[model samples]
Target: MGLEIRLLTARDTEAYWHLRLEALEREPKSFGESAGEHRLSTPESATERLTTNPEDNFVFGALLDGDLAGMAGFFRYTIAKERHKGKIWGVYVREDCRGKGIGRALLAALLEKIKACPGVEQVSLTVAAGQSAARALYVSLGFKTYGLEPGGMKVGDEYLDNEHMMLKI
Candidate 1:
């Protein structure tokens, strides 16, 4: 399969929304947002999000044979004091596509774009505890764990912890 990594655009809104909901539903504990919440979001919102500013906010998508299979996002903090930091969010690879390094390619592309943004010194992300593969991927990319947030998410009476990690660019 041909793998292509590129910034997502408004034209990809529908596919991106579907993939995001799939991520939320299939791996509920992996994200901070719930499928229920995402279901309430409109396509217009997704389009707006995809219409990003490369300098501060953007999403990278991995397409396998022209199909959206993985995605990663970045947004620099807007607050004056936190402007030097950015956060990675909504990282997911389709279950069928997991073993192909799509996530790594998506992240590497996102990180390369983040590095070009002015004043962004560090990038931060949170991975749900117990997700060994995801954590391992982040570590392989030079992310260092800084702390853990207990009970970061609650799904059907089960509390999930999140490990905070950061990479300095």
Candidate 2:
């Protein structure tokens, strides 16, 4: 069967949980949250995350054979004046499923969701510095790096930097 790209929901909690844990564990510096922080998260909260409250948040998933293969999430600022922009985060593809366009698919779908939002005119995201593949992917999809956050994160003693990119919708 072909891969399916669509919105994730509360019913996808089980698969989503495991897939997200993989992202946190396998690519610690690439994400904002550590696996330990996510491990403390409850299943109910994960499910709640999948339940889209479109004005502010949504998640898109890429599935193959009914398993979650990748995902991307978007969050819009709820403050009155900042609603015109959104941020994309939590982008990941399953290890065994990489190099197969799943991440691009998830990102494309997420962008479409953002376009559907009435006031969202732009979307921004941050990628770990030196992550060429992911940065290239975002660049290929029309995102441009506007700045860099030097030593944006510290994992143990290693300082991780990030590149800030934005796309005009």
Candidate 3:
């Protein structure tokens, strides 16, 4: 596979939006957003999401043979007291592209960019409690479990808990 990991831009809005919707549809439990909600979003909104502001927020995409196979996003907290912390969100790799290192590469690239952001002392993320593979990958990348949020998300009548983790840079 001709794999490439790079920052996503406005030109990548369509691919990013499609992959994001796929993630929300196929792995609803893994994401905080619902597919229904995403379906209601406009192309302009998707384009805005891909707008890169490195010091504040950005997304990294993993392309396999020029096709978007995975993506990960990062954003720094805007609150004055929380400005030193960054959060990782919307991480997903296509089901057909799993078992490869696409997730790792996307995350590695995101982390490298995060390290360059001024005042970013640590990175944090939440993984659904049942997602062992995702949790393992985060742990392998030096994130430590800080706490568990009970009922972090709800899908229909079911509630899913999330494990909060952080990596101090």
Ordered from best to worst lDDT, the candidate numbers read 1, 3, 2
lDDT per residue (tens digit) for residues 142-161 in model 1:
99999999998788899999
Spell out the clash pairs found in candidate 1: none
TM-scores for all candidates: the values are 0.97, 0.96, 0.97
Q: For candidate 3, lDDT tens digit of each residue in 1-169?
A: 9999999998999999999999999999999999999999998998887784555899999999999999999989999999999999999999899998889998999999999998999999999978888998999999999999999999989999989999999
Model 2, span 94-169: residue lDDT tens: 8889898898889988888799899899999999976788999999999998998899988889998989999998
lDDT of 3: 0.92
Q: Evaluate residue 6 in candidate 3 and report its C-alpha lDDT on the 0 to 100 scale.
A: 93
* CA displacement after TM-score superposition, residue 23 of candidate 2 (Å): 0.4
Cα RMSDs, all models: 0.8, 1.1, 1.0
Q: Cα deviation of 32 in candidate 1 (Å)?
A: 0.7
